[model samples]
Target chain A: MLGTWSDGPTKSAIVDFVGRVTTEGPNYVVPEERVAVFDNDGTLWCEKPIYIQLDFIVRRLAEKAAADGSLADQQPYKAAVAGDLQWFGGAITKHYQGNDTDLKVLAGGIMSLHASMTVDDHAALVGKFYAEANHPTLGRPYLNCTYTPMVELLRYLETNGFTCYIVSGGGRDFMRPVTSQIYGIPPERVVGTAQNLKFEGADGHGELLIQPALDVFDDGPEKPVRIWSRIGRRPILSAGNSNGDDEMLHYSGKPGAAAMRLVVLHDDGEREFDYTAGAERILDHADQFGWTVVSMKNDWTTVFGD
Target chain B: MLGTWSDGPTKSAIVDFVGRVTTEGPNYVVPEERVAVFDNDGTLWCEKPIYIQLDFIVRRLAEKAAADGSLADQQPYKAAVAGDLQWFGGAITKHYQGNDTDLKVLAGGIMSLHASMTVDDHAALVGKFYAEANHPTLGRPYLNCTYTPMVELLRYLETNGFTCYIVSGGGRDFMRPVTSQIYGIPPERVVGTAQNLKFEGADGHGELLIQPALDVFDDGPEKPVRIWSRIGRRPILSAGNSNGDDEMLHYSGKPGAAAMRLVVLHDDGEREFDYTAGAERILDHADQFGWTVVSMKNDWTTVFGD
Candidate 1:
C-alpha cells in the first residue's frame, strides 16, 4: 500500500489505474507489458532552489577555479558561481533552446571536467558528492530529499509487476549511483542524457574511458524519442512535474493505449517549495490532456523521508 | 538440468560459474548484481550466410529498386544486392571499422529505408520480415534457428534471479521483436546499435519517427562503452562468439570482480557452421584471458530447437 499517500482523489486514481492494469480481464496487461517510467529531478525529489545536478556542476566548477584560478575568469564559470540568473539562464538555456554552438561549448566544458577519469573513477567522485552535498534550503543530504510518496509509489508499482524506470533530464551516470538505493530501480533502468565513452587498451585488456563529448541530450521531445529507442516499449504509466516532462507524459498517454499519466504539482510551501516554475504550461494543459495532477499539499501525507 | 548441453569442460565451467555466483559463499553475488550479457547473432542464433539484419536491408533495397530503377545503379546498392564481397565488405565494414563518412552514408541508406515510419510501424515491418524471411542454408525461419542450449542457459539464469541481456551488434529495433519470445529476454534488456529518432506531431500528441542518422554503433570496443552508459553495471557473466565481443568480454572480466566470460565457437559443421570467421583472435586468446570457449560440436548436445 502507498502509506505516504493521503486519502484523496489523486491516490484513488493511482490505485484504480494499477488495479485495472493488473487484474485478470480484457483490460489486464500482462506482466511483461507493465512498464512504468518516472522523471527524476522534481518528479522523484526536490529540484526547487536549483536542480541538484546543476548544484553538483557548480561545485565542480568552483573546485576547478580553486585549483587553476584562470577558470574563475571564464564567462559562464564566473556567472554560474556568482549565481547570476541572467547570464546563467542565457548560457544554459541556449543549449536547451536548440543553439548548436552553445550546446557544444557547454558540453565540452562539462565533459572536459571529468573526461580524463575512467567511468569507475567518475562514479566514485559522484558518490563522494552525494555523500557531502546538502539541499540549500532543506539543510539535509540531497539523497534524503526524495519524495516519500513517490518512493512508495515506485515500490507499489514494482510489486504489481511493473518495471519502473527513471527517465530523467539529469546525466545518466549521475543518477545511477543513488537511484538503486533510493528508488529500488537498477542502473540499467535509469535513462538520461549521456556522454560518449571510449574503449581503450589491447585485446582482452581494455577499459571504457568517458570521453569529452555529448551523446544524447534526453530532454523535451527527446524524452519520448529516448524512451522509444532505449526502452523499446511504450510505458503504460509515466510521472513527471515539469515542462521537460510534458512530451514524455503525452507520449505515454498516446491514443489506443490504456495509459495513465500523473503530474506532481509543487504547491505545498509549508512542507516544500511552492512555485510553478517551468511547469506552468504542463499544469494548465493537465485537464485538457486528461492527466491526473497530484498536488503535494493535498495528495501526500509526507514530503521527504526522515 | 541442462538437457541440451553435452558432457564437456565448457558445460562444467558454465555450471560451476553459475553455482559460485548464485549460492551463498565468498564469491556469491547479490541477486540485484546478477547481470548476464550475450551476443545475439552467432551466439544465440545463426549468422553464417550473413547477418539477418543485412538480409532485411538487402531485401528492402531490392523493393526500392523495383519501384524506382535508379537504385540498381548505385554503388553500395548494386554491390550489396549482387553479394559483391569487395564493395559490400568495404562499405558495410566501414561502419564497424570506424570510417565516419562511410558509416554516415551506410547509416543514411539504412535509416532512409524506415525513416518515415513510426517506432511502432517500423517494429511491425520488422515482424513481417521475420515471418517471411528464411535462413539461406538451414531452410527454416531465422527465429527458429536460435541455439537450444543458449536458450536453455538464458532461462536457467533467469530462474536463478540473473537478469539476461542481448548485447548484440545488430540494430536494436531489429532484435527486439523476437528476443522476448525466442530467448525470453525483454526489449529493455536488448542493447544494440541505434539511430536518432524524432518526436513528431502537436503538443500532447506525437509519435517517435526513426530518423536517418547514426546514434551508437554497438560493435568492437563500442560494446563496453554502451554497456557502461546504458546498463550502468558491470556484468558478472558475458557470452559472445566474435571479435566484436572482445572488448565486452574484457570489460566483464575486469579486475577484482568474480566474472565469467564464454565464447561460442561455431565449429560444429554438421549442426551449424565450421569456420571461426571474425572470432579467430578471440578463440586464440581465450586461454590467456581465462575465458571459456564453448564448442558447438563438443559442448552442445543439440544446436537448434525443434
Candidate 2:
C-alpha cells in the first residue's frame, strides 16, 4: 500500500511493525488498540519556507489590512506583511521574558479575524484559500505538497484496521477543511489547537460561533495532553519530524508497550526543502529512543504527488 | 438491529434517519459527515440512584477514609459519607453564589482519588470497580445496567457507516475502561471530562499521571465547545437526557443540516428508577425544538441487559 516508499530499512521496519501488530504475531495489538497518530506539518506534509497555517494567517492578515487600512498599523500584522524577522524575534524574546501580552494580542488578532462566523463558513473560506494557495518554494498548490509516501502509509494503516489521527500543531479548523479531502482522515480524528466557541441565536436556530482568543494551544507537551484528553487512548504508533512533536513521539514510544515511532528527516533538498530548523533536537532523541529515522532522500521513491 | 426497542415512533424515526443518511435518499449524508454522538449517563446507561461515577467516587472516598481517619474528618467527605443532601445543596447554592471554593475542594478530592496513578493502573482500577459494583437498586452489575436498546442503536449506526462517539460528562479515563467492553466503542472515540496529566519518570520510561484538578469540564455549553474543539465537526445525530446536553443537541440540530436529536426520558419506574431531576428542562426543550423524546416505559421493551 505504501508504494511511494522505497525498498529500504524504513519501509521494512514499518511493514514489520504493522505485521507484528495486525497479524497473529507476538506483538499483535488488538484492532481496538490500533491507533496511529501523525504530526501534520513536516511529517505528513511540507513545512518548509514557513508552516502552511502561518502562511494562511499572514495571507488573512494581509487581506484584512487591505480591507481595513487601520490593521496595517498593528505591530505584528505590519511586521508579518513586511516579513520582518526582527519583530518576530522580539516577540519570541518577550514571550521568553514572561511578557506574552503581545503574543496573545497577535494570536487573538489572528484568531478573531474569522470570529462570529459559523464553522461551516470559516471552513468554506479556508477551503477557498487552499484552492488558490501555493507553496512558496515548491510553486505547487499547498495541498499538493503533502508527502506521497506518508499519505500511502496512512492508507496502509487504515487498511489494516488502524484508526489514523492527525495530531497537528496547526489550527484545528484550518486543518479540518482539507484533511479529509487530502488524507482520508475525518475532521473529528484531526486534533489541533483551537479557539473558544460560542452557541449563538435563539433556541431552535443557533449557530456555533468560533471565538477569537486561544483556547487550547496544542503544541509541544499539549499535543500529548490533547491527545490524551480528546482521544482518551495512547497511540500505538506515532510519526513526527520537529521538536514540537518530540514529546508526543516520546509518549508514544514509552517503555513496556510494543509501539513504533518514526521521525521523518527532510534530507532530499532536490524533491523538498531540506532545512532541519526546529527539528534538530528530534534527530538526537530518535537515536536515543530507538525511533526509526526515515531519510526522505533514500526512503521515499516519490516526495509529493506533484 | 435495535431489538430491545419497541415498534414506536422513536425507533422508527431512528431507523428512518439512518436510512436517509446511508442510502441514496433525499437527505443522504456523505459517509464522512456521518458523526453520531451519545451522552453516556442516562442516555446510554443507567444514571439512576446517582451517577455511576459519583457512586465510584463515594466508594473510593470511603476506602480512603478506612485507610486514613483524617479524611473522614474532612467536611465534604464527612458530609458525603452521611449522604447529607443539605451539605450538597448548600455547596451548590454557594457555587451559584460565586464562591466555588467548596465545590472545587470537593471536585479536587474526587479527582485526586486516583491521582499519580498511571493510565493503565487507573483503568484497571476502574475496570475492577465495574466488575464488582452493582446497581444500587437493580442488583445487576453496572456494566449490565446499560440500555439494551441504546447498545443496539450504537451497533446499528456503526453498521451503517456512522462513526459513533460518546460525549459523556463522566471522567474520560473512567469511561474508557468500560465503554469498549460495554458499548463496543473504543477508548479513543470516548470524549469526557479530564484532569491535567504529567509525564513522570525519566525520558523513555515515564508514565502520564492524571492530575487532581479540572482541565476540560465537558458539560453544558462546554459540550459543544469540546465537540467543536476536539471533534472539529458538528455531529449529525446527538443523544442525551439532561439539560447539560441542550446546547450540544442544539448544535447538532442546526438549521441547514439533516440532523436528529433524541432525548431519553426515564419514566419506567418498574424496570428502572423514574425521575427527571436534572432533565426537566430538556423535556420542555424537546417539545419546543422538535427533538425526539424516547419514553422509557413505551419505547423500550427491555431497560437493561439484566
Candidate 3:
C-alpha cells in the first residue's frame, strides 16, 4: 500500500502492528479503539527551512512592522522584517535545549498574529497564504511539501480501520483550513495549540472573536495530555520526527497489543534537510525502546508525492 | 424513526431539516459537514434531582468531610456532608439568574474532587459510581436515565449519515466513560469542561495527573467557542435543555441551509420535575429564533427507554 516506501524495517513494523491488531487473536484491538496520531511539521510536511506557520506569521508581522514604527522596534518583529530564519530557528533550538526565554517571545508573536479576528477571517487569511505561498528553499507550493511515504502510510492505515488525526504543535486554526485537502484528515480530527475565543453577541448577531491569550502550548509533555483530553482513548500508533513527540510515543496503546512508534530521521541533505539538533532526546529513546526509525535518505524512493 | 415522539411540530421540524439536508438539492449538505452537537446534562438525561457529576462529587466530598474536621466546616463541604441538594440546586439556579458568585465556589469544590489524581483513577471512580449509583428521585440506575426519545433521535441521525458529538458543560472525563453505552456517542466525540493535566513521567512510567484548575467551561457563550474549537465546523443540528445551550443553537449552520435546533423542555411534573428556573433564557431564545421546543410532557410516550 505504501508504494513510496522502500522495503525496510520501518515499513514492516507498521504493517506488523496493523496486522496484529486487526487479526482475530489476543492482540486484536476493536475498531473503535484504533486511534492514530501524527505530528504535522517535519513528520508530515517539510519544517526544516522553517515551519510553514512561522513563515506565514513572519511575513504578516514583517508587513505590519513596515507600516508601524512602534512594531518595528520589537525583536521578533525586527527579525521578521529582515527575514531572519536563523533567529527564529535558534529560539526553537534553545527551547529544545531546555531554555524557553526567547521561545516565549516567539510564541507571543505567533499568538498576536491571530488575536482580535474572527475564526472564519483567520481561516480565510491562512487559506490565501497557503494557496499563494511557496516553500522558500524547496521552491514548491506549501501544500505539496508533505512527505510521500507518510501520506501513503496515512491512507494505508485508514484503508484498514484506523482513524488518523493530526496532533501538531502548530496553531489549531492555522492547520484546520488546509489539513482536510492536504492530509485527508478533517478539521475535527486536527488538535493543536489554541487561542481563547470570546463570543460577542451584539447588534442581534453572535460572532466568536479570537482573544489574545495563550490557551495551550501543545508541545512536548502537553501532547499526551491534549491527546487524552481530545480523544479519550490512547493512540494505537503514533509518528513524529522530534523530541516534542516523546511523551506521545510513551502514551500509545500499551500492555495489550503491539503498538507502532515511527520516528522519521531527516538524514538526506541531498533530498531534504539533514540535521538532528532537536531530536537527540527522541533519538535516544527510539534506540532504548526499540522503535522503528525511518532514515529519510534510505527508507523512501521519493520525498513529496500525491 | 422517532417512534417515541408524538406527531407534533417539533418532530416534523427535525424530520424536515434532516430530509432537506440529506437529499440532493440546492439545500443539500454533504455528509462530511453534517455535524450534530448535543448537550449532555438535562438534554440527554434527567438532571432534576441534580447533575450526575455533582451528585458523584458531593458524595465523595461528604465522605472526606466525615474524617477531616476542616472540610466539614467549609460551606459547600458542610452542605455536602448534610446532603443539602437545595444548596447545590440554588447555586445552579442563581448562575442562570446572572449570578455566579456562589457557582464559582461550587465549581472550585468540583475541580478539587479530581485534583492530584490520575485521569485513569478519576475515570475508574466515575465508572464505579455509574455502575452502582441510582438517581436520587428517578429511582433507576444512573446509566439508564437517558431519555428514550433522545436516544432514538441520536440513532436516527446517525442512521442518516451524520456524525454525532456530545458537547457539555459537565466534566469531559465524567461524561466520556458512559456516553458510548448510554447515548451511542463515543469518547472522542464528547467535548466538555476540562481540567489541566500534568504529565508525570517518573519511574519509567507516564501518568496524567488532573490539575486543580478549570481549563474551559463549555457553557453559555463558551459553548459556541468550544464547539468551533473542537469540531472546527458549525453544527447543522444542535440539542440542549438550558440557557447554556442558547448560543449553540445560534451558532448552528447558517446562511446556506436549514438548521435544526432542538430545545428540550422538562415540563412533565408526573414523570419528571417541571422547572424553568435555569431554562428561562433558552426558552425565550427558542421563541425568538423559531427553534423547536420539545415538550417532554407532550412529545414523548415514554421517558426512559432501551
Candidate 4:
C-alpha cells in the first residue's frame, strides 16, 4: 500500500498494526476513534536548509525590505535581504540549545509580517507563492518536495479507516489552503500554531484580522494540548521527525490500547540532505520506547512524491 | 430529504439552495467547499429554558455546593443549590442587553469548575451528564431534546455532499461526546468555546489538563473569527437561532457566491417555546437582510427527532 516504501520492518509493522486494529477483534478501533496525526515540515515534507514556511516568509520579507529602507536595517529583514539562510536556521538551533533569545526575535519578526494583513490577503499571498515558487536547492515546486513515502503512508491509513491530520508548528492559515490537495487532509483536519484573529465590524459583515501575535504555539509540550483541543480524542497513531514531536509520540501510545508511533530519520544524504540537528532527542526516545524509526536511506525507494 | 420540515417557503428555500449548489451549474460548489456550520443550542436543540451545557454546569455546581459549605455561599453556587433556573438564564439575558456584569460572574463560576480536572475526567463528567440527565422543563432525556428538523437538515446536507459542523458558545469539550450520536456530527466537526488545555508530563506519557480559563469564546462577532480559524472557508450554508448567530449568518451570504443562512424562531408555545427575549436583534436584521426565518410553529411538523 505504501508504494515508495522499501519492503522492510517499518512497512511490515505499520501494515500489521492496521490489520489488527481494523479487524473485528480485541484491537478493533471504530472509525470515529481511529485518529492519526502527522507533523508537517520534516516528516511529510523536506524541512532541510530551512522550513518551507520559513523560505516563504524570508522571500516576502526581502521584498518588503527592498521597498522600505528602515525595514532593511531590522535583523530578520536584513538577514532576508542578504539571503542569509544560516541566520534563520541558526535561530532554531539556538532555541534547541537552551537559548530562545534569537528564536524570540525571529518569531516576533514573522508575526509582524501578518499584523497588517487580513487572513484572506495573507492566504492569497501564500497561495500565489505555492502556485509559482519552487524549492531553492531542489529546483522543484514546493509541493513536489513532500516525501512520497509519507504521502503513501497517509493514504494507506485513510484507506484502512483512519482519519489523518496535519499537526505542525507552522502557521495554520498558511497550510490550510494546500493541505487538502497535497496531503488528502481537509482544512479542518489541519491544526497548527494559530495567529491572533480579531473580529471587526459590529453586528454583521465582520472580518478576522491577523494580529501580530501567536494565540497558540503548537510545539514541544503544547502539541499534546492542541491535539486534545482540536481532535477531542487521543490519536491512535502519531508520526513525526523532531524533538518537538516527542510529547505527541508519547501521548499517542498507551499500555493497553494498541497504538503506533513512527519517526522519520533523515539519513539519506545522496537523495536528500541528511542532518539530525532537531531530531536527536526524538530518535533517542524512539530507541528507548521501541517506537518505529524509519531510516530514509534504507526504507524509502524514492524521496519526493514526483 | 428534509422529512421533518413542513411544505413551506422555509423548506423550499433550503431545498432549492442545496439543489442549485450541489447540481452541475453556475451555482455549483465542489463537495470540498460545501461547508455548513450550525449553532448548537437553540438551533440544534431546545435552549428555551436554559442552554443544555449550562444546565449540565448548574447540576455540577449544585453537587459541589452540597459537599462544601464555603462554595455554597457564592452567588452562582447558592443559586444552583436552590435550583434557581432564572439566575442561570438571566445571566445570558444580561449579556444580550450589553451588560456583561452577571455574565462575567457566571462565566468565572463555570471556568472554576473545570480547573481541577484533566480533559479525560472532565469529558467523563460531561458524558455521564448526557447519559443520565434529563431536560428539566421538558421532562425528557437531554439527547431526546435536539430539534428533529435541524437533525434532519444536517443529514440532508451531508447526504448532498456537504460537511456540517456545530459552532456553539457552549464548551467545546462538553458537547463533543453527544454531538456524534445526537446530531450526526462527529467530535472533530464540533467547534465551540474552548477551555485552555495544558500538557502535563515531560517527554513522554503526557496528559492534557483543562485549565480554568477560556482560550476562545465562539459567540457574537467572535463566531465568524472561530469559523474562519477552524473551517478556513466561509460556509455555503449556516444556521443559528439567536443574536449570537448574526455575524455568522451575514458572513455566510456574500454578494454572489450563492449561500444560505437559516435562523430558527422559537414562536411555538405548545410544541416547544414561544419567546423573543434574546432574539430581538437577530429577528430585526433577518427581515432587513432577507435571511430565511424558520418559524418553529409553521416550519416543523415535529420538535424532537424521536
What lDDT tens digits, residue by residue, belong to model 3 across residues A1-306?
A: 899888887777778889999999888988889999999899999997888988898899898788788987787898998888899988988988999988889878777777889888998999999989998888789999999889889999998899999888888989999888988999999999888888876322467788878877889899999889888988888998899988888787664456888889999999889988899988988888777799999999999864
List TM-scores of chain B, every candidate: 0.93, 0.92, 0.97, 0.97
iRMSD value for model 3: 2.3
Which candidate do you rate higher for DockQ, 1 or 2? Answer: 1
Worst 10 residues of 3 chain A by lDDT: A200-209
- Candidate 4, pairs of clashing residues: none
Model 2 TM-score is: 0.93
The candidate maximizing DockQ is 1
Runs in model 3 deviating more than 4 A are A202-205, A255-257, B202-204
Relative to the real complex, the DockQ score for model 1 comes to: 0.66
Per-model TM-score on C-alpha atoms: 0.93, 0.93, 0.96, 0.97
Writing each residue's lDDT as its tens digit, candidate 3 over B223-282 gives: 888888888998889999998888888888665467888899989999888988788878
lDDT of 1 by residue, B158-194 (tens): 8888999999889999999888888888898899998
Judging by TM-score, tell me the better candidate of 2 and 4: 4
Which portions of model 1 show Cα errors greater than 4 Å? A79-108, B79-108
Error of 1 at B127 (Å): 1.0
Q: In candidate 2, what are the lDDT values of residues A1-306, reduced to their tens digit? A: 888889978999999989888878678888867888999988998877667877787777777878888878886679767876455545534653557877776786787788888888989999999999998778799989899999999999988999999998878889998898899988878998887888764675567787877778877778877777767778899999987778888788446768998999988889897767667777888888788999999999889895
Q: Report the lDDT of model 1 for residue A91.
A: 52
What is the lDDT, from 0 to 100, of the residue B17 in candidate 4?
Answer: 93
